[model samples]
Target: MSLSDDGGYGGDGHRGPETGQTRTRLPGGDGDLYGSGRRPRAGMSSRNLVTIVGVIVLLLAAIAFANRDGSGNSESGGDSPKDTGPGAARPTAPTGTKPVTGKNGQIASGFAKTEQGAQSAAANYAVALVSANILKPGERHAIVQQVFAPAKVDDMQSRLDAAYSTAFLKKLGLDAKGDAAPGMTYVSRTVPVGTKLVKLQGDTADLEVWCTGLFGTAGAKSTTPVTSDWFTMRLQLKWAGGDWKVDGFSQQDGPAPVNGDDKTSGADQIAKAVEQYGGFTYAR
Candidate 1:
């Protein structure tokens, strides 16, 4: 996210990108993999060729044997644990813990002192940070104060106010108050796909939140039709007065997938769906 809106492969040879060590083919550091560019004997003997082939055959047989699966008749009768590879990612699932029944004017509050709570806080904070309500100066101030730490409220409010000015809102077909025109719905909603806790210690925690959202206007005569965006937010949270509050925020464009070929709903249908289906609290 150029501080705005936008930021993988398996362990196979084909990858999007890679990090850490690479297989060094240089001659000096690791051993030379190409046998120091030595030429083969011009008059190679048949015995040597046969011996090399035999070694290769044995090596291939050993590899095949090592990769074979069990026959399923062993006494233990259990399969081996899977190695998910170096690029395996953690799966998201419900922790089965209920969220606290608390709210600070639609924003969540009173999170527990746990990693799950930090994740939940990160998700909600990201949602509020990008909502259409941020277009309104007063609402934006309130949101910043509620989701951020007390020490950061003033700076955050000022920064957001500058980003969502009167002119910016106008460009998006919104008024000074961030409201759509009559019979129109200005859509902005962030739905977090998953959250990963990066670090947690004492009164501070860091998290990564992957999200998708709908943004634009919903009306038959609207210029900006609702479109979806995918992004990842990195949040630094601090435990304050028995709750997790946002301390730092940054975003980047997605690990997005190819768009699907789905039927586009009418503006009226889209508006009605948004109104009827309320957003979730996102406890993980």
Candidate 2:
């Protein structure tokens, strides 16, 4: 199943056991020849046939009555089973809060101080951190400064800079400025599938954001062809500057699904699609 299709209705059907008949000997008079190992009377078979038909009908009715899911039982003025009712569950309900308004370059900022805000911050931060824009020196510094807590900024910047060094960019077919060669498109985008508020305390929150993304370069001549990956980013957030900020973060490979059977697109088609689509500012 795709990430987009979580918690859907299955309408699983339950099958009742097959119906059958059991023969039993009833109290009989001396004329009961069948059980006596004698030839049965001619007219007696007719009465036995009638009895079998009645038993089959009654058994079917009992089976049908036992298998009801009880949805319509209340309408008949009967008490439904306590475990079964029309009550619903909203396990994944929306927070009813809107997306953050403020922006720091392409990254969202000024998130609310609530749990929803922390989750929203984590999700948007995932997008910004995994984005193609982060490869560029200017954008990388700006993102680190605006999205991370004050104490984390310097460390994160140094680490990211080293990770995306000149040699790394060259290997990935990008220039020193993190730009793709002409006729090629470097694609890096993270689409958040969902978010979880793992814990929340007075001034801190721990959250996880599940995401799937496109990464690498897309072009026929490009050595690094863009591919998709799944990963979950865990964010340690703290309330700061009247908003939630990332104190630190870590990522794990995935809860990935098996690859699907969709037809693969050409390099030109992938490049065109990336250009046509825009990124999102996510919320819980």
Candidate 3:
């Protein structure tokens, strides 16, 4: 989404990321079995019909049992069984490899030359880019410099400055400097749910990150109370200066699921939670 004057819903009007669609087939009628001009024999009793159905059911069950261990269950053809699970596989345990051992300013840097490293870099950069610090001119510039390729940093910084201008801050109930008013807590946090490497070449990679973010102000008097959002960011990364850096990126509304029925927290509680929790440096 763009960082324009309309809070965080600045781009397209979609509520969340695009979700997969489900298809369903209704049961066909038995009219085809008995022709329009034909009917079951008058001699046929209800008991006979029941028996016929039982036989058909048994025959189908036997066929299914016979094919239980057939090609449908094999992993070599069609879609792999693992790929047809409820959603993406559960994240594996850490491989004991550190995400990144180096930092550029406050952002993670020095990623390894591997797919995992690319994912890690994308995740961390997603978090940093959506952070409240990105609204401040100085911190925004620093973050752009650290997370982006050196060649693109200046251009990105200029674009971002315009995107997060004073008018945009005012629309979000913040001041000219992007600070929340007194007794209000401004929130802009991103949590990466998962990362998928869409394409990987020798020195470039495209990664999509599913993320949930909290943004807006928190306080009883706040016009824009804190709220959550779901989206996927597609990041085009390049191996530059010996580390994975963002070359460009785009965002789309989500693969968001239905919201739960839990009670909403009060302004004070939300504000306290945001203060008590710290963000993580994510890895794939």
Please report, in order, the local distance difference test score of every candidate based on alpha carbons: 0.57, 0.56, 0.59
CA shift of 98, model 1, Å: 3.0
Worst 10 residues of 2 by lDDT: 8-17
Which has the greatest TM-score? Answer: 3
Over 1-284, each residue of candidate 2 has an lDDT whose tens digit, in order, gives 01110111000010001121111122145322112122222333555444434432332232233222211111212232232322111145676666586887777887887766777898988787667776688888998898878876776677557555776556556789989999888777778888876667788776667777765456655433444666666667788888888765555556667655344456677789999988877876
Candidate 1 lDDT by residue in tens digits, 65-160:
221331111111123223452112467676677665599998988888887788888888878776767666788778878988888777656655
- Kindly provide the TM-score of model 3 when superposed on the true structure, using C-alpha atoms: 0.70
Using all chains and alpha carbons, the TM-scores for the candidates as numbered come to 0.68, 0.66, 0.70
Query: Residue 83 lDDT in model 1?
Result: 44
Order by lDDT, highest first = 3, 1, 2
Candidates ranked by TM-score:
3, 1, 2
Model 3 weakest lDDT span, ten residues long: 18-27
Q: Model 3, 234-257: lDDT tens per residue?
A: 677889988998876655567777
- Whole-structure CA lDDT of model 1: 0.57
The most accurate candidate by lDDT is 3
Q: After superposition, how far is residue 217 of candidate 3 from its true place, in Å?
A: 0.5
